[model samples]
Target chain A: MAKRVGMEVSIAVAEAVKLADADVIAAYPITPQTHIVEHLSELVADGELDAAYIPVESEHSAMSSCIGSSAAGARTFTATSSQGLALMNEMIYIAPVLRTPIVLAIANRALSAPINIWNDHSDIMSVRDTGWLSIFAENGQEALDLTLASFRIAEDPAVCLPISMNIDGFTLSHFIEPILMPEKAEVDKFLPPYKPQLWLDIKNPISIGLLGGPECYTEARKATDDALWGAKRVVIKAFDEFNQVFGRQYHVVETYRHEDAETIIVSMGSISETAMTAIDEMRDQGQKIGLVRLRLWRPFPEEEFLAAVSKAKNLAVIDRHMVMGCSSGPVGLEVKSLVYNSGLRPGISNFLLGLGGRDVTRDDFKYIHEKATSGQVQARCEIVGVFE
Target chain B: MTKPTVDAMAKVGDLPMGFTAKPGSTVAFKTGDWRSVRPVLDREKCIYCGFCYFYCPDGVYQDMGKDEKYYKADLDFCKGCGICAHECPKKAITMTLEEV
Candidate 1:
């Protein structure tokens, strides 16, 4: 029988990584994300999980070591939060450039200026162009499920790029939630033993990370881009297969009561859950408002997002962090870019809210819907809940 | 017999997967044409200490048996980096301009 337990999401992520049977884990301790690596270390020490738990000195070293281990034909994993992810930025770029299939669990935290340890999308947004497959988890169960799915997707021969699974720090990471943990046998059936197509073996030598001249640089970059796009298929397939085994379905862009709704609120991470409640509350009052949550952030899920929101007259995007100086947040910017190109002119209103762990209540969602529908939102985006 | 520069296993053209074969697979793509300065090893002054063999980044020096007497640089893979010539203990190696 599968085990169901109430545990912290970080601990659950650690359990999920262990369940994936990762060969190596390299990570450093960072707030909200510390429990993940801590638990993973315990599993390694207790001999419950047979893997190398590399307690690297820094996040940079953590990622570098993960790259080395993954390149050496090992299924590797690592976890980090805001500043930790920022430190690992260079290696994050290299991981995809080398096509190393290392799974990174990011407990998304706010970036430092005042050095706050709160949940936000700033960390992951900072490395958006790093060419890794990115996914967001709405709750503990999705975090656990997606962590397992990351390994399956990243290591696929067709999609040998690194993947980052984002779990909102403090909010999702610290909460003790009841989750159905998959049996090792079932996980084993869902995910096969990883056999790397390309590896650094001494016996059969192969040159990797060769210097590409002006002639080959474009092709090299093109190859990485194409690999990420192709990985979308493998990602969708992995989620589908996971659903088949676990009986919980997931999609790139998951909608909640979106049909027949004239207006929809768009968001990602745990905030989507709040939006769901708000949407349901509004729906009961005979408001045609629904929620559209983006689960897959990277590869952008353009087609699905467009299809999901095409019928809606208004799109209110709730971004946890803003792009600063830009009219909207990164999600809003990308959504606009996608919508603009498709020639679907919806009155898109972007709301920057819940930054630095601020509470975004159900009332806030209702207010956003009102502002968006009444055309009171400024030019493109508005900083909601800020006292002027 | 002169072997072809690119072997069957060496990946040529655009690598869509970024998958490369074995370490030093660039041996198949000879860098001899990249030479501006070529190292000339004098057998008379050479002590066969294998410093050139040890120092050359490109694995240009080919060791013929264990003897110090028959060490020769394979021009096919040598990019004329001259680290071998600079590291020669006995001053027996000279970096000569290539006849390009």
Candidate 2:
């Protein structure tokens, strides 16, 4: 059994990265995500971890340096949030195309126009098409566990792709909770030294970045798409192996009291925990309502999601970010698109809630469930807790 | 180009993802076929100044020793951009039409 210690979520993630023995950590400090990079810098400065802690000027350079370091066959890691992720948008796409297995910890935060430094899915949702393996952490233990697992998944020979472990800003990133800290020896047995399959080297010089004309551009894209889809198998295998080695198990779609529910509330991030409390209260009163949490966002887990929600007749999707001028939220849109042809007809009501970390209490979830269950919602999607 | 090198390029199917060759792989890819006009050097009026060598973006001009022939363009890799011809001070180079 691992020793349990109480620590801030961001520090736990940094400790996990330290145990993974990362060769390089290049990052820029941003609100909510600052503690992660700050602790990593201290590890390097205190000689606790032997690695290069590059304090880059901006997130763009941070991701660029991470790409260069990973291409040079180093185990590279970085952390960022909100605008920082937006700044590194160009390099984020390059990491997957170049097959550089760099690990990123994104403290999921709201994007700015009014300049809000709070938790939301807008930052993570913005990079939905960037072709990185995106996963969400519900709590501190998961934030730590997934950080270690990301390196394994990314560096896996079958799945040589970048990964993003999303920690909800201020909610999960700042929350202090008791978590099981695995020993270094236990982690060492699980994750081995990174052996790069393809790399930039001097001795065995090779030319990369060949010109992809119109004739070959589609083919290159096809290959990349195929690789990302194939990564799902490796992701499952890694989770199973992790469970076998360390006693904690995870699924693509985790359910709570959903065995024979008529209505299921779907969600992601830390709010899923709040929804669980709401579901428990609803179930005690025989309301027949349950909860479904999406653990994996990208490589979207369509089959697993369909199977998980198949038992429910109605679904109430809670989205943290609002897609302006859209029919539904991003997650709801994807879920609707996926289940359109599945032949399992179920009414999905999207409730766009918790923008910029708005207070979404148990009563709010109860309201969403009541509205979705009674089919009293006027549109397919509606904003909750807004002044409307 | 060597037979094996050309064979390898032919083996690359529709998608050439991260296709890497030797250090000087660029030498293997001939760009002369893309040229609509070729640089014709009037070596007789040539002054051995290496202006064309410095101006050619493709490194087309090759140094032949300082004895008599100072430099000449390697046409197999030249796109004939006319930079070298435009930069020649002595009017020793001219762009000639490459027939289809």
Candidate 3:
């Protein structure tokens, strides 16, 4: 497939919405995510997408509308950033439990106290356990590609959880780039109309979201948990199906020349882009360095992450945010947990970097790469070069 | 005064799975111990920020109608968590749990 030139991240987002053939879009504008929804709303206004562009009063209503639309068996989407995501916090817990395959684009942004509008993991990390299958995108192309991928994974009968597709706030979402938009016909062939085994059927008129007692509550949770566990394979299937259609490959945990490299710096979201740039620059200088990027966050691809790092003698897991009162950084904790379970244990440890929208300069990568190679692994997570 | 029979019992929602807030099960509750003397938000002092509503898991606070200027806390459901009292920014809903 030839690359399409100059489509902004927001427009790439719009293109994905068109490809997914979403039935409804209910979203409120909030910075970075605003552009994505603005483009999507324009697509709706221009008669490009046959969908409802709901100008909702608040992010809560935006998610509520998505829940309502998805329940009616309509393929639904919404995008939000920063405080908008905070506002949607209530419904964040509800959409997945309802098993509505609602895909949302979360342009990752910092939540407020001092009220800054900058790129940070604070917003998405807050909803980490909201039961949505989460994926982070590295660039504009991946953003578009994964938005389409999200639908296939989300609507999979075995994986009926809502999917939140994350693009870094102001990093990828605002950055202009050239990318490929797959032919709508080909995309349609890949993703069929979402047929949820559970939906609101007017003619049949079945009950949805019934209040369960102690007896059924556990079953409801088990159903969603089982579906998530089931999603592990369904995600691979969806990726395999996509790869067959296009020559592109999708890995839950993507490796960029990570094989056999003794030391690698690992992170997610836009930090992966910086990490790769570091890899390219260092590799050109004859340094045997590599990188691993976690594209999928939820359904935490533990087995795949282990395989990616198996050959490495040294590995540094970089987290973009803090877990607050703990010995763990959020991503660092997950990586450590996976290592603890894997048992095959290469020389793996954790590092905290690029928190609260602090820029991870190319020089910063050089520092982290050095930390990866400096012999002794921290018995636990280390704050990599972050000034105390 | 006449008491309603079991056959004539009025119910609200459908029975979910098992017992609910039933009349005489051993599920202990300290409804009496849960009482507090928080200042009923004089609606006049209410800005309707809705913080009280969000903080209340018991659905204790709700607006009665469209014209309702401020939400009133439902004393029936209020478990006296005092979360609302502590979180109230305007110091409007005060706690008098202790007597002056």
Best by TM-score: 2
* Candidate 3: segments with Cα more than 4 A from true spot: A1-3, A284-286, A379-388, B1-100
Q: Candidate 3 at A24: error in angstroms? A: 0.5
Docking class of 2: acceptable
Shift of residue A334 alpha carbon in model 2, Å: 0.6
Worst 10-residue stretch by lDDT in candidate 2 chain A? A207-216
Worst 10 residues of 1 chain A by lDDT: A211-220
What is the C-alpha lDDT profile of model 3 across A275-387, one tens digit per residue? 88888898888877888888888878888888888877777787766676777677777777777777756666677766556788777778777776777767667776666
lDDT of each: 0.87, 0.86, 0.77
Ranking by DockQ: 2, 1, 3
Q: Return the TM-scores of chain A for each candidate in numbered order.
A: 0.98, 0.98, 0.94
Model 2, span A227-283: residue lDDT tens = 788888888888888898788898877889888999999999899999999989998
Q: Please write out the lDDT profile of model 2 over residues B12-42, one tens digit for every residue.
A: 3433333334466556657587888999989
Reference-based TM-score of each model: 0.89, 0.94, 0.77
lDDT tens readout by residue for model 1, A261-338 = 889899999989988998889999999998899999888888889999999899998888778788889988898889
RMSD (Cα, Å) of model 3: 11.6
Clashing pairs in 2: none
